[model samples]
Target: MPFVKTTWRNSISFKVLLAYVAGVGLSILLIALGAFALITSRSDILLTTDVAERTHELAGKLLFDAAGRPTGFDDSEGDRVWTFKSLGEEIGYRVLDSQANVALASTDQAFWSPVAKAAPSEQGHFKFEREGIPMYAATAPVEHNGATWYLQFAVSERLMELLHQGFAWPFMGAGIVLFSLVLLFVFGACAYFTLGYALKPLREVSESAATISPRSLHSRLESKNVPWEVAPLVRSFNSALERLEQGYRVQQEFLATAAHELKTPLALIRAQIELMAPDKGRDSLLDDVAHMTRQVQQLLLLAETSEAHNYSFAVVDVGEVAQQAAAYLQRMADAACVGIVVAGPADTQTPWQADRSALFTLLKNLLENAIQHAPAGTQVRVEFTTSRLTVRDWGPGVGQAQLPQIFTRFWRGAHRRDHGAGLGLTICQEIARAHGWTLVAQREEPGLSFCLSRHHAGPG
Candidate 1:
């Protein structure tokens, strides 16, 4: 039951499927952009090349006078219209008397924009716009007998739109076809066989695990047949299961021993109380009762710490928690002459994903432990933020050698007084682990600093 409710609610296969979809979607988006751009560019280039070839052919047909100087255009069939034409290409226009105010434009003139703006050196590719449409234009500048002749042509926005739409659907259709085929034939087949191979060891392991009871949890999944990618995870799971089963055995033994041990002493105390006169042993009886109560509380806390059942994760406001815990401990601190101050800003909201009650207990225990070890009249401070909670006490700082074992259960440091159940810091650390945070005891030179930090999700 303890292991059944553990945290892997979102399975690995679902995450992998989501990753695959996202990866493919991103790849599709990029390919779409590239394919669109390439198709449009090729269309424009093809049209421009056709116009250039025609212009060059026209320019080659030169008419010469008797003096061997260029005289006029070769108007062979008296068709001046054909001379200025872009040779009926899809994306070309011509400039007429460009040095003058007069410029003749084709019906789809927006394509001239890019070809028009191009420098004269570039076989004259430039950009020009006409009538609210954009265009790509290419011009060939030639001089005939002291007169300048210019020919320009453009590809229109309508044509560019048409070109993109024409090619885009086909490209996407092809992508869909290719993607489906690959996933069905290659990836599906590979995954089917690979999954069989991958799950073989897991199936065997599960069979072995299913056959096991609490009596035989020491048996483990075989490591030799496990896939390399999954072996480490299986090994860790096996190790944890082994540890849990051992702890179960240890706890069972402890409970049995403790019950027998406690019953005899309690029975003796009860017999003594029944025999005593009210005035004779009332004070001693009260003291023994109090001692028994403290022992029972300590034992219960130690058990809970081992089980880690005292902790549960949720959003906890640490600043508010500090105030609450400080209030809880104020009476004891006051009796001990310790100045306990919850010094952080009250307006601060530090919502921590943790066990609220366990956090309260952790802080309360640390503060109580500090008050026990602290010099009298010392100040104890508790501060909190979104990612960290810190407690400080002007106690003689912890020693160098004893630092490592400070959070080990039942560890009493050198400055130890009659602090109840040296499991306070151990509980704090255990609670931190349950919430995936860090609980660290740090030396503050003349004092001690305990920090519970939310490990940030990055390399900050």
Candidate 2:
């Protein structure tokens, strides 16, 4: 339930759904309140109208009796009779002569109480509580047989209270509940469908964008049939893609040109140095040329693998690749006094479609980095599976702070090793990314482990 509440608070669709439901409920409540007010006002008007009519009738009865005319009573025969017996049981009344003395009453006992002890209201109406019973009361003056009389009447509010509590209040309460539930259900459903419909174009844009690679930069977002609010963003994104494609093309041309221009002079220099007399200085010059040549080769490899350059995919055995990389780099590891060990399924021939050259580069760089950092006589272990490979070495592991930046281009840590441009792990990351694989580095207890996995994709 907490998770659901959190989701409702966080999610846009749920927020919209709740907002609509709340708005509908508020509107229904306002309408119900207005209806209740109107009904109560009309009930008050009917009660007051009844009071005025009874006051007029009482005055006429008194005037007729005083004029010695028939009042539907035989007062001369000593039997006092009452009129207006048809009044409700909840109703009570009193009559006062000119002196404010009680001359007649509808009930056997007095129910109407004066508003004040010294001076009572001559004509008006008000609500009051009498003996814990709520009543609506009124007082009015009338002329009868050349004198004045005052009539005070009251109606018990108990029946009206019961009527509202038993029926009206419950009906209103049920109405509000029913309205809230139906509003939530019906509006929530409609909003869900409406939001899906509204967001359909954005989903399409995402799917189309996912398919666009560095190779397919010519692809642009389709603005037609999309929402007006998102159309400008699509156009801007397509424009940015065009600029990036131009930059990529220029970079690829420069790398190709640079490699061709530098390789010829570098080869000639190395060839000329080999013909000189063998000496320490001469050997050092040759070593420098060899290093420069290796750097140039790595630069070209980095350029090719970094972008959407075509890669060859074929059925290659994982164990065989690990064995080959270990064998090729064995001499260097030996010179560094670091041992190499390949461990995996014995004689396993699980062939997978992959760019063999790219995989070799990835493996070679990892091995080279591991061997360079491992302590003397410490073994570097390379493990292989059908879908994963891990290379681990027993050297001081990378700093926790520097782990995230290890794969960044041209990034080097404060450690001791051979001097070379820091493109090894960067190239490895690019190759992995190009093949839709994940290459992650983790700090081992004594060293570091680089794992390459999810190697399951066809030629792109």
Evaluate model 2: give its lDDT.
0.76
Candidate 2 lDDT over residue span 1-460, tens digit each: 1433455577666778778878887888787787677456647665566556654554445533655332332344223233235544566667666566766677654355524432224456666666777777676776655666666667667755555667877797788778777777887788889998987998899799888876677788888878999999988999998999899889987986797689999999999999999999999998899888877887888888866656877778877887889999999998988999999887668565679988888899999989888999899999877778899998998899999999887786555378666789988988887878889999999999999886446351
Cα RMSD, model 2: 11.6
Candidate 2 ranges with C-alpha deviation above 4 Å: 1-15, 43-181, 203-225, 271-284, 413-417, 455-460
Best by lDDT: 2
Instruction: Return the top candidate by TM-score.
Output: 2
For candidate 2, the per-residue lDDT at 296 reads 82
Tens-place lDDT digits, model 1, residues 47-137: 5665567556545654546653444456662465453355334454444443422244443343343333433445465555555566555
